[model samples]
Target: MTSCEVGNDPFLITADQVGKLSKETRVSQLGEIYKQDSIVNRRFDSTYIFGGNEIEIYETSGNQLLRLDPKTPGDTASRIGDIRILDPAFKTEKGLSTRSTYKEILENYTIKKIENTITDAVIFLEEIPAYITIDKKHLPTIFQLSTTHKIESSLIPDNAPIDQFWIGWE
Candidate 1:
């Protein structure tokens, strides 16, 4: 594995890695990987609902950082299927974070596609295995409500801020 740091920081995100967690990091290794941070396992409830194997990582200061979902629920050996970045401190090497805007994203990476959902426009990046969402409120009226309508990247305002950012291992 390459050195975890990007510059002087270890929290930098890349296409194949997120800080100390790489594509090969497994569910069983979370505790060891985040030993300095707080780890919370959100297991399924008694109602028999299939709540996913979501593992939350928090700073010692009580700030949430990331939510990790394993590829196979209840399987300790499963690799991370998704990583939801919750803190703004976790930024891509290109400086894209949860706080980044569409313009920043466009300037830093190539857009693969734009998917229109009822409440948001999901922007997929070509250079990175990640996607960012812009809330419907930031979109033009025509593209806000209809899921059937395909949203082009050009339609989204450049200043629209990303509502959520997620990295997919799959």
Candidate 2:
């Protein structure tokens, strides 16, 4: 009878090889921005998502939300060009205006004017202003573009860096 068994090889998988394999692969996703009711009872919420290298910003107040999408979907290629938010006071060190709501922001803003125009049967934002207004309150309040909440970036991935055990295999 012929023996068809092969001996185990420990040299093929060494300690260094195992260490190299343990290195994790990671992808970044944006974070959520929100204001809790516990503090001042202000109604503000925002969720940011980054995937395939693109950034998305979703802002919510009351029952309204606005979404901003990036040009690039690849994480390494995407960058934040310009971001504007309306808040409580129209004062900042950066010299940006701040109104309480979207209506106030648009009214106080000096750069862009809100006018009606018709050309190709489509209504669009013609002149991109320095700030975009998100008016949540409409009534006795003086409508102003004010930024009360701060925007930030966060990382999101299915598995943490320490969890990705297998990747880039031939």
Candidate 3:
């Protein structure tokens, strides 16, 4: 087995590391890195599509753990562009996970920005270089109706739960 396949905790997440995977880990190494887990690759039929290949990691018990997008689709050597943490078991050193609330995030990390999308509010964190998204339904009616409006931290309720958590290598 290679170095990538051994001695790395699978549940720990950091700014430059997630379990056995790191910023330098390539697409080809995923199989080895996740040898104990199940990997499902969903590639687009067309080669023209960018960021179309999504790789899912699942536990033996059939619980989805993560969704990874490669920097370049179909390129075995490509590093991970981004990773979406699907399981609440996977957490950062500070104990932030999918189940963490907006208030917990505020207490733990520095907020870089809050981006308003059609259905979600994506909050960027400076320390981990990660983003946590909250569904717009959790927001106030006025904030949910406008996608162009700048979403400030104070505008979000402390009890709002995170809908998605993503770590970007870039």
Q: What is the lDDT of residue 12 in candidate 3?
A: 86
- Candidate 3: residue pairs that collide: none
Better of 1 and 2 by lDDT: 1
Per-residue lDDT over 49-127 for candidate 1, one digit per residue giving the tens place of the 0 to 100 score: 7666688999999999999989998899899989999999889888999888999998889899888888999889998
Using TM-score, rank the candidates from best to worst.
3, 1, 2
TM-score of each: 0.91, 0.24, 0.92
List clash counts for every candidate, in order: 0, 23, 0
Candidate 3 structure lDDT: 0.88
Model 2 lDDT per residue over 1-170, tens place: 01111112211111111110111111121231222211111222336633422222233443222122233333433432222222222232222232232333224333223211121111112222232222223211221233332211111111211110111111
TM-score, model 2 to reference: 0.24
Q: Roughly what TM-score does model 3 have, to 2 decimal places?
A: 0.92
Order the candidates by lDDT, highest first. Answer: 3, 1, 2
